[model samples]
Target chain A: MLGRGEIAIVGAAETTQLGAIPGMSQIMLHADAALNAMADAGLKPSDIDGVACVGPMMPQQIAHYLGITPKWVDGTGVGGCSFMLHVRHAAAAIHAGYANTILITHGESGKSRINATPRPPEPESLNGQFEAPFGPFGPPTLFPIPVLRYMKTHGVTHEDLATVAVVQREWAGKNPRAMFRDPITVDDVLNSRMIAYPFRILQCCLVTDGGGALILTKSDRAKDFPTRPVYILGTGESVETNMVSQMADFTSSRAFRVAGPTAIEAAGIDRKDVDHLMIYDAFAHLPLYGLEDLGFCKPGEAAGFIREGNTRPGGKLPLNTNGGGLSYTHTGMYGMFALQESVRQMRGTAPAQVPGAKISVCHGVGGMFSASGTIVFSNERP
Target chain B: MLAPGRAKPKPTPETKHFWDGCKQGKLLLQRCGDTGKAYFPPRPFSPYTGTRNVSVFEASGRATLHSYVIHHRPVPGFTPPYAIAVVELEEGPRMMTNIVECEQTPEALQLDMRLEIAFTPMDEEITLPLFRPAKGGR
Candidate 1:
């Protein structure tokens, strides 16, 4: 597993501003965050030897745009989980002597649609042929199927899901950067206009434009960095069926199950060792699934776990303290922000810092729980 | 406010028969001869065994609702508040479809409710297979 603590994140930063950028294209945001991270690390773009991003051939694009000619590159775009996987892949590449320093960047102009990239509509693709014909707009249309099924089986009430949004908003109140900092109640969530049955507007993430970047190098060389290093204790990534129906089980994400356990096992750490957590909350039910699949709670125990305030601020396990994608900034794929928050918390520099946090776990999902990436980090090496 | 247009699906060689069967008001299941596994959305090779020795058979059109969501957003061609459903077919494979001729509500669209296949013609050459509450519970 490249031995725990082999790689460390030496620099991390998001674009100076988030939300509603009508001028900057998506790629420009990538460059902006990359430059910001470079400045934070006190390293020029030329110092980076590796680059990674989501989608095909993006590593080459971001690297060249940042004025870097990399020896190694990875473009592992598995939906929102892509950046999390990029970190895992970059760490492995570094350990394998493929490169010394790696850069990972994420940028999505989700709301503004400035210079937006259009994905080809493959009508003949399995999902296009089978699922899309049924008239679902997007995740809002499809995700509720699994969640409704989850509710019936697990006895998770509609209000229980609403509580997920309420609690996260309470945390968001402390984050000035959060898009929705106003306090919300469970009634607010339940009464909000329904986008899909079982999902209100409050349960869904906001549409915003943002970008983030990270730099990683061997931990042995990390002390020279300008910021406190967040060592990579372990990472795991996996993918499941693209069509949610084909998911082996609707109530659980197999990708999350695989990735979460692999990371904790590789790190040789138990759940108790985690001082902070970030489970990508693209929707209210996601954190519920993430909690169970990642072994943070027993099956059917997560909804009540949150309702009781276990994950809210001042709770025993403070999760998504950045307010999460639900109340924070969600620039389409939200994994990058989750990782960024984990880095900040581990360094005790988070906007809503978890005091003296030494270890943090960030879990990400892509394409309706179709893919998952889990990473464990620590400010201290075992 | 589902946009007033529906995205059409194009069939490939592997899936042509399934679409053709839909045209004839029949649902088809792809069965792998080697593995005895019947799968949905027909393909050339077995997803489990990777064997190309697959053939199609008529499905009974009986299914039970697995899960569903009532979408209030605008789907091109679909009005607001329609049920998008996944049904477990009698043959055992689940299919993503829509529920027609029933109230799109939690009370009406109960999980594990019995449903039967229904078809909607998109255009002259294309017919979509959907589901509705089955008569007399199977």
Candidate 2:
């Protein structure tokens, strides 16, 4: 798989301000993060030969805007996890001599709706024909469709789901940049207003305005960068179904089952080697599913594993130390923020850094468990 | 006004029969002639084999609740709260539908409850095949 650690992330940074960036348009958020990442590595846009971003035809838009003439470009917008796929594709392209330095950027004016184009329902499309007639407002309604089935089959209680958010907020409480830093209890989560059945408002991710960017290059030249290189040990990306209703299984993610193992195997590491982790918490139920699907716990055991204080700070596995999408700022597509946390943890620069954490596994979800991408990072040169 | 302001499905060449069947009070599913697998949201070819040799047939319109969410937000035509459900058809294909003539509450809407299709015409151009509690079943 292109040899482990062949590609290294030399530069990584988010926009100057994250929470409410009404001042920046969607495209400008991308540019702001790109410029910051470039400055972090002591490089200019002229040094980058490859560019990638979310959505179709966006690579050309971002590359041209940054005044870069890229030889390799990728616009693999599967969903929120599209940035994870971009990192995987960029690494392969750099190794294949397609480009020297590759840049991946993510920006969404989710809260401000600045120059944001809301997708109109297509009556002629498959979703419009079958699923849309039932009245799903968006991710809040659509993503939770399978949770009742999951809870029934797994014997998971509502309190188990609330624990996922409660623990992540514990991590968020340590970060000054987190959107919600106050300590929250499981009762507090349950008492919050219900947006959907079995899911309180605290369980859902925040819609914020932010962006993040990353710069990847060959590990052989990693020493030349100003920032410490976070080596890309392995990456895997896969999609199960575009329609959430068509998912093969409601309790487990097929995409997560495929991507997580593929990445861990590609890195040739066991579960114990991963000291820190970031599972995209678009909702509280996601972390429960991710933990099981990624082989951290057996089927139906993740809820209890999380409830037992295993993933909290000073626990065996510190997960979502940046508060994750639950407490951290989620700008629609949260994969970039997850990757940024992983890079920070590996470099020992995270706001709530895991002590001596060498390997960090970052797993992300797109849409309603529609797609998944798992990336394994290590500070140690493999 | 039958379901005013609701987004209606625009049938494509391959999916026309399914919509047409709903108008005539029938639930049609596409089955691959080569593999004998019945599928939903009709497509021309089999998803398993990619063969266009497929046939359309009337389904029994019987399904069991696979999963659902009670959305509490107001949408275009739906009320403040409604059950958006996915039902596992007896033929093995699952589809997203709504449960009608029932209270939209967890106490009332039980998982794995038997359901039967009740086609409601949204407009002259489209008819939605919704489901309700099956008669003479659990």
Candidate 3:
């Protein structure tokens, strides 16, 4: 078992300009975020001894771009939540004395497609054989495959789904960096153009061009950094099925149920101890799944919890305070941004900061609920 | 004319049996020879027990609509508002497919509706097995 608070995030940052960047290529976005994070921590790239990142960009590519020769490297690209898993791996590596300082970067030209490598699995791959042939356009169509079954089982309504976007947009209003800051309502969400059945354009995540990075090191050295260190209390990562049709249950994610409890238990905290939450909202339904799977609310109760304004601004729990992928910038791999938001909230510097928030849980989903990573963060050392 | 942008399956050594069976208008499923557990998207080895002793068998092709989406986006070979669905085969595995021979509307694509397999030959090599609403004949 990993020791609690053994690793600390010494630095965290996103690309200087998020949303749409026509200038920076994908790798430059990764470099830009890396340098910015190094700057935030008052450390040069030379100080870093380890590197990690998602692919189609390799860890060595990120290390070379920033002029660092790391002793350890990680290219564990599972999906959007790969960065959370990176933090977990980085923590384990540090605890095992693999490397001292590790930098994990994420950059995707999801919208601009600038120098972006097309990463389709081989035609003979599992997805190509079983899923791609169905002509499911993309996440809009593919991710929502289980929605009808979930809604039918849970009694979650279109209005209830619409309310998720509405509530998150309310949080976005306070954020200048948020792409869409204007207030929206359930009516506005329902009235939006349909992308797929039961999913409006407003309900889907934004396809923006951006990147973010995080730097991790032992907690002992974290206090020496210029920026306030947010302790990595615990982490858990898991995967269920790459194919959405094969999800163990349509109503809940098997990965989420496993990763969330493991991290919370590792952190040695009860669900009530969490002061702020960031369950990745790549789609409106995800937060609902995240809430119930994480045990923040009972099954079938998350929609009502959001409708009651519990997760809205100034409610009992402030969720997706950075507006999430729904209104915040989602650069395809959105886990890094969620991690950055959790750090900002713990640091008491979030634009929509929650007052005296000590413990925050950031949960993420990758590839249509195929994988999950849960990381518990605390401003106070354990 | 071949439909532009419609992705076709590339059969592999392990999955060739499934595609070949589809060409013969049979929905073939693999079962663990040891445990007799049936599985889909064929594999050389049984997912259960990690046993290579697996047997292929023709299924009844009868299924129930487990879940689906009425996709409005225009993809190649498909018009707006098509039902991309997941159907649970009576033998016990769920697979992604298109619900065909019915109006592509939410009101029509009811969950738990009975469906039967229908093979559409994309080419000489690939015959995609789709699901259509079952008639009164069980």
| lDDT (Cα atoms) of all candidates against the true structure | 0.89, 0.91, 0.92
Give the residue spans of candidate 1 off by over 4 A: B1-4
User: For each predicted model, how many residue pairs clash, with residues at least 3 apart or on different chains?
Assistant: 7, 0, 0
DockQ of each: 0.80, 0.86, 0.88
Judge candidate 3 at residue B84 and give its lDDT: 84
TM-score against truth, every candidate: 0.97, 0.99, 0.98
Q: Which residue pairs clash in candidate 1?
A: B1-B74, B2-B74, B2-B75, B3-B77, B4-B77, B5-B76, B5-B77
| Model 2 segments more than 4 A misplaced | none
Q: List model 2 lDDT by residue over A251-312, tens digit each.
A: 99999999999999999899999999999999999988888999999999999888888999
**Model 3 residue pairs with clashes:** none
- Candidate numbers, best DockQ first, in rank order: 3, 2, 1
User: Which CAPRI category fits model 2?
Assistant: high
Total clashing pairs in model 3: 0
